[model samples]
Target: MNLEARKIEFVQEFLKLQNEEAVSRLEKILRKEKNASNERIFEPMTQEELNKRIDKSESDFRNNRFKSSSELLAKYE
Candidate 1:
């Protein structure tokens, strides 16, 4: 790559190590830009939707949609 690109990449990696908050903010900005580029993309889920999903996940676990680790290992063996 070009010298400028290499410099920018190094700065980004260094910032990721030295300033995690900056790195996280940069990632958030990039994700928003990517989502904005796609008009048909769905909006972010609301708090209510997230709570419902969490409840459903808990229910699924209680109903054993996920098998035990020992059972998984036994099946593999």
Candidate 2:
């Protein structure tokens, strides 16, 4: 009924698929889930975006930006 249960059911159904076409479909479904999970775990962060963000933060610190490290830590945490 829930997400985890659905995932397990998907795997069970995938494993049970006997026909070549059915197995291919199941493989596609599994691949899609795998890609989605991987994307969520390791999101694309371009070098430029990372560099700009770091530069902005370093400048912010030099300029004595708001409050404290706790604020920054909250963003990263």
Candidate 3:
């Protein structure tokens, strides 16, 4: 079956579940899978990349090219 269909089927089965332990296991599995997926997406930057970012930040500060935290917060509010 396709992914969407499979997800619907899974949800239907999950909704009928009567066991707390089974639901807890599913929640733990989902959290673990999500964390692993995030780790893969956000791999640590290299030393060279870190240095480049630091230099850019320093330049922006000297040039007054950045905004304050209050200014940023005000923008969304």
Candidate 4:
């Protein structure tokens, strides 16, 4: 069936659920998923933008401007 029809069917079945604990668990899962989706911040970058980033990173590496993993970890820690 279509999306709306599927949603209605799900709601009907969900309403038939009699276990409060099960419903509460499902509600928590759905809320967590919704919150996780809302927390996303990054958008997809264009190929040109990606290329510019790669070029900049390569230049920095060649100039010894980049930090090693251990250095970064130590600094952050």
Candidate 5:
């Protein structure tokens, strides 16, 4: 069946549900599916953008511009 017809049928079946736990479980599943779809909307960086980031990182390393693991740990402590 088409999407709208399927949705109407689902609603009809859902209305007939007598179990509260089953409805709650279906609600949780719907929420998880929605959150997953939202997460999939994020765009990744292009290869050129990635290369530029790598180049900047190398320049920072050459200039001794980054922190050390010990320095970072000391600051947190």
Candidate 6:
């Protein structure tokens, strides 16, 4: 009923699990869900913040201080 009780129940049931494939699938699903939840922890930027970032980026471009996409990708490849 409570969170701890539910976790205990889940652990008990998980301990009884016998299927390797099912456990692997469950592990992948849990990991993917955890990653997705973590990615939502950041709040979206406000309009003013967005505009400031855009202006800074334009300034950097005008100053020739930024890398091109092809140049960036070349390093990884």
Q: Write the per-residue lDDT of candidate 6 for residues 1-77, one digit (tens) a residue.
A: 99999989998998899999989988998999999999989799999999999999999999999999999999999
Whichever of 3 and 6 has more TM-score, that candidate is 6
Cα lDDT of model 2 by residue, 15-62, tens digit: 887799988876798899999998889877899999999999999989
- Clash tally, candidates in order: 0, 0, 0, 0, 0, 0
Per residue, candidate 4 scores C-alpha lDDT tens digits across 12-73 of 99999999999999899999989998779658999999999999999999999988999989
Clashing pairs in 1: none
Model 3: per-residue Cα lDDT over 49-75, one tens digit each: 999999999999999999999999999
Question: Each model's RMSD to truth, in Å?
Answer: 12.2, 12.0, 7.0, 5.5, 4.5, 2.3
Model 2, residue pairs in steric clash: none
Q: Show where candidate 3 strays beyond 4 Å.
A: 43-49, 52-77
Model 5, residue 57: C-alpha shift (Å) = 15
Per-residue lDDT for 1-77 in model 1, tens only? Answer: 99999979977786658667877887798799888889667699999999999999999999978788999999999
In model 2, which range of ten residues has the least summed lDDT?
Answer: 9-18
Query: How much lDDT does candidate 1 score?
Result: 0.86
Go through the candidates in order and give each one's C-alpha lDDT: 0.86, 0.87, 0.98, 0.94, 0.98, 0.95
Q: TM-score: which candidate is best?
A: 6
lDDT of 5 by residue, 1-77 (tens): 99999999999999999999999999999999999999999899999999999999999999999999999999999
What is the clash tally of candidate 5?
A: 0
lDDT of 6 at 58: 96
Candidate 5, residue 66: lDDT: 100
Ranking by TM-score: 6, 3, 5, 4, 2, 1
At residue 66, give the lDDT of candidate 1. 78
Model 2 TM: 0.39
